[model samples]
Target: MSEELGMVIGRGFDTWKRNIGIAFPFVLDMLFSGIFFLLVAGVVALVIGIDVFLSFTEGAGAVFGSMEAGENPQIVEIFGLVELIRPYIGLLLVAFFIVVVGWIIIR
Candidate 1:
């Protein structure tokens, strides 16, 4: 079983090596998608106001503060920003899925 697994892994690597051309575009797409997400997040953060965003950071800081004070730190504050973006999460996921599927189909 181990030898068969090794052969399968080797064949997979060989296939990937041979398909570098097809793989490169997917790599670029992933890179661009990550950059785009950061840009959008930054823009949204600005539009929502720094104070509002900082509140989330501050909440996270408070959790750390509690730990420093030798108390139990609440970790839920770390997800504050995620909560703020909850409404947009579905749209982002759907768009990302579409892009990935389209890339696969095109390749």
Candidate 2:
């Protein structure tokens, strides 16, 4: 590497080592926030039930199966996937809203 590039890289490392302490609080905050959101998501997913997920997976399987066979999945198959997800869209939206509210409150 060139001399100028080496110096810059060394300085960057030194700066990061000196300032890493400043990042700890932000890292911890994100960790806690992620945990909070995951719990909220779990509760929301429970309320949404397994049936929707099963249907979604089934539709996805059909799409993947076609791809695996080197075929472009037809529009109808894509529509089937969308149809499976359509009914649960509202529940998913509510879950997202709840997570957003929780994030705002935490922040």
Please give the lDDT score for candidate 2. 0.82
TM-score of 2: 0.41
Model 1 bad stretches (over 4 Å): 1-10, 53-107
Lowest summed-lDDT stretch of 10 residues in model 2?
Answer: 71-80
Q: Write the per-residue lDDT of candidate 1 for residues 1-107, one digit (tens) a residue.
A: 35688899999999999999999999899999999999998997687577556666766676666568776445544454456566557767987999999999999
Q: Distance from true position, residue 67, model 1, in Å?
A: 27
Rate residue 78 of model 1 by lDDT. Answer: 42
Among these predicted structures, which one has the highest TM-score? 2
lDDT by candidate, in order shown = 0.75, 0.82
State the lDDT of candidate 2 residue by residue for 36-55, as single tens digits: 99999899678666777777
